[model samples]
Target: MIDDAPGKGRPTRSRKEAEAARKEQMKRPTGRREQMRRERERRNKLRDKQLAALDGRGDAAYLPARDRGPVRALVRDYIDRRRSVAEYMLPILVVILVLSFIPNPTAVTVVFFLWSVTILSTVVDEIFLVIGLKRELKRRFEPGETKGAVTYGVLRSTQLRRTRRPRPTIERGEPLRDRY
Candidate 1:
């Protein structure tokens, strides 16, 4: 077979030989244990990096795109500096819950109204906050810089401050500088 010339009225390989060659290409498992170990290692590495970033201990390179920019940093600072009514929302909700159980209809009505007002005011406040943030960002940054940031800030503000991930780098009531 090795001495056979290329396709000169004689096929280089028989059909059985070709079929055996094709069958030789099928792969067996490298072993399930090895594959599982490698996959576990990959997941552990990814999870470590992700948790580091979420814990605010990751370096700039590991930080997510949404949290990397100077503008977003400034937005974080601005939101962190001021105390938002929304930040107090959990406590307010507790109060409302307690008030709702009062036997008096008047008490329930009052609590309901209070909750409505709180929700309304929170909406208005968040709207204005986003609007002002947008205007300032437009003035300070080129367009597309602030995209998705308004919603980011708004959602961040609504989260109870203590529970915020990528935890606050600035102290509450910190004076903001015009560094942006």
Candidate 2:
């Protein structure tokens, strides 16, 4: 004789009891969990959209391929040019020091101050520029290549100098040197 219970001879929950169980489960913290899940899903969707936008290409399209020979050569050339400045900086510093000790100490001091300020600012500007340029060079050049480092350093410095923020006020025809 086979027992013909709906749950294959096992006890089965009544409809009212099952409905109450489902209601209790529904009344639990499932809403908060669902809310968290939805938030994560939304965030993932936004991230995907942003990634798609970035991949759509404007400036990224203009960036040279990392393996481009010409790009590597250009970086090498820049590095070579920047390295040459080290030789000149020493002589320039010595000359400035000598001039600062001359009879017209006021003029010498002013000149020295101006020169030092310019050099210091230039160095600071170069650091930021180099960071950006190195990123670009790494993007363009193959790994382990140092050729672009110097060139990137110098050009970055020069570019930074050119793009530096202008002082708010300048008297009529007064040079930036005078303001400093």
Candidate 3:
């Protein structure tokens, strides 16, 4: 005899019927097209998530390995807060390249001179950046806690500001906070 109380909504399933339903629900899709569709959807979602993370609009956990961690965050902020000559190197180099194609000797000399000056300025800017960053690191973190931070900062500084991944969170000349 089945128990049908006043408040009960529906009858319970028999054991065999419940098991069959569970098995059917758990079964993988058997068709090739269904499998491909599911796989494609998953890949598209992952791609969107990664792109969002790279643009700094998504979770920090989804950021690339190199961009993760508090130390790296500090490094990114440090580099972003200052202006560097390296940021101009790419555009300047392109101009110099175009200038090199000219047949005139004067153009060649001018391109060579610009190249030397740009290279020198970039080296000087990066040197100061490294030294200042090292001092800040020593003040804020234990030795070795900031391993690879200088290189990371240098690399980040070289990119055009607009093209930097995980776009700069702070504007130029923004003062850093005391805590990370």
Q: Which is the leading candidate under lDDT?
A: 3
- Estimate candidate 1's alpha-carbon lDDT, on a 0 to 1 scale: 0.81
Question: Relative to the true structure, how large is the alpha-carbon lDDT of every model?
Answer: 0.81, 0.51, 0.91
What ranking emerges by lDDT with the best candidate at the front?
A: 3, 1, 2
Give the backbone clash total of model 3: 0
Give per-model TM-scores: 0.70, 0.32, 0.78
lDDT of 1 by residue, 37-79 (tens): 8889988988788778767777545667778777887788778
- Candidate 3, residues 65-112, lDDT tens digits: the string is 999878888898899999999999999999999999999999999999
TM-score of 3: 0.78
TM-score of 2: 0.32
lDDT of 3: 0.91
The positional error of residue 3 in candidate 2, measured at the CA in angstroms, is 84
Stretches of candidate 1 off by over 4 Å are 1-30, 64-68, 176-180
